[model samples]
Target: MKFTFRKYERINKQKEIDAVITGGRKFFENGLLVYILKTDRNYSRIAILVSSKVEKSAVIRNKFKRRIREIFRLNKYKIKTPVDIVVVATQISVRQKYKILEESFLKILNQNGILNL
Candidate 1:
């Protein structure tokens, strides 16, 4: 899979984010929270959120966002259905390792039947 995160693949609009949060089904594993809403597009779009409540430092928050985005980018192909996915990081995620985060993310995807593998 190409490991590029493109602009079209990102859910950046506030209205879109709100729709996903309000209309999507939710899944939680470890410190990772996921909201998924089916869309008409052929490919999935994603948003990663690292709240200030999770970490006070901007660097820490960005790190979490990057890690989650990387995980999603790498596993994007596993999702057969077209959907909008929003990933929210918790305070515990600030200190967690990338592997832990990846595992938790995959677990939630599997639970939601979004991951083909």
Candidate 2:
């Protein structure tokens, strides 16, 4: 599988993000928060959010986003459902290792019944 995060696979518009946040089903595990909404498209789209409340530094926030994005990018194929997913980072996320984040993310996907694996 290609390990690329394409533009079509990302939720960039603020209105879309707001809609997902407001209308999606929410799930949380080990400092990782996920909001998932079923979409009309055959493929899934994703957004990664790390607020200032989670970390004071912009660098740290960006790092968190990058890590989450990488995790999703690597495991995107595991998800069978077509949905819009918004991933939010919490304060505890900054301290967790990459493996833990991956596990937490997969747990969320499994709980949502989106993971095919």
Candidate 3:
């Protein structure tokens, strides 16, 4: 399986983001709020949301986004089912390291049966 977070593998449209954030199943743990919507599409897509509450600086916010995206990008191919995922970083995420965030993210998905791995 290909492991890449390409442009097409990103949820960029406002409508798509809203749909995933509002209509998907919600899971929260370790400073991450994840919304996952199962889809028929063969490929999965994702979006990372880091609000001002998480960080005041754009650099920090982007850093968080990149970390979350990397976690998703590396393990996305392991997802048994295709899903549109929206990951929102809570205030605490700004203080969490990438390893902690990744572990929490994967654990949540695995525990909820959203991800095969």
Candidate 4:
């Protein structure tokens, strides 16, 4: 499959985001705050939130967003159900290496029981 995160696969609508924020199950692991809500769609969608409080530099924030997005983009297909996912990064995440970040993300997926193998 082509490695790409399309606009449709992103949780960009305010209503959708708000629903996840208000009702999704929350998980905190490896400096990442994950919010997930089951959806009726055929596929999952994602959003990455990196607040300025996490880092003062826009460059750093964008970089962190890209890394988190990439991690989700690559592993999203493994999810067994359709879900709206929001990944919020904390300050501790900025200092971690890519591998560690990926591991942490996978751990969260595993913990949620959504990861298929």
- The 10 consecutive residues of candidate 1 with the worst lDDT sum are 87-96
Question: What is the C-alpha lDDT profile of model 2 across 7-69, one tens digit per residue?
Answer: 999999999999999999999899888999999999899999887887999988888888888
For 30-97, candidate 1 gives per-residue lDDT tens digits of: 87788999999999999988878778999988888888889988999899888999988888876789
Clashing pairs in 2: none
Candidate 2's displacement at residue 95, Å, is 2.5
Model 2 misplacement above 4 A: none
lDDT of 3 by residue, 3-59 (tens): 767998999998999999789999888778889999989988998888887688898
Listed in order, each prediction's TM-score against the native is 0.95, 0.94, 0.93, 0.93
C-alpha lDDT (0 to 100) for residue 12 of candidate 2:
94
Runs in model 1 lying further than 4 Å from the true structure: none
Say which candidate scores most in lDDT: 2
Better of 2 and 3 by TM-score: 2
Q: Show model 4 residue runs off by greater than 4 Å.
A: none
Evaluated at residue 74, the lDDT of candidate 1 is: 94
Model 3 TM-score, 2 decimals: 0.93
Which segments of candidate 3 are over 4 A away from where they belong? none
User: Model 2 compared with the native: what TM-score?
Assistant: 0.94
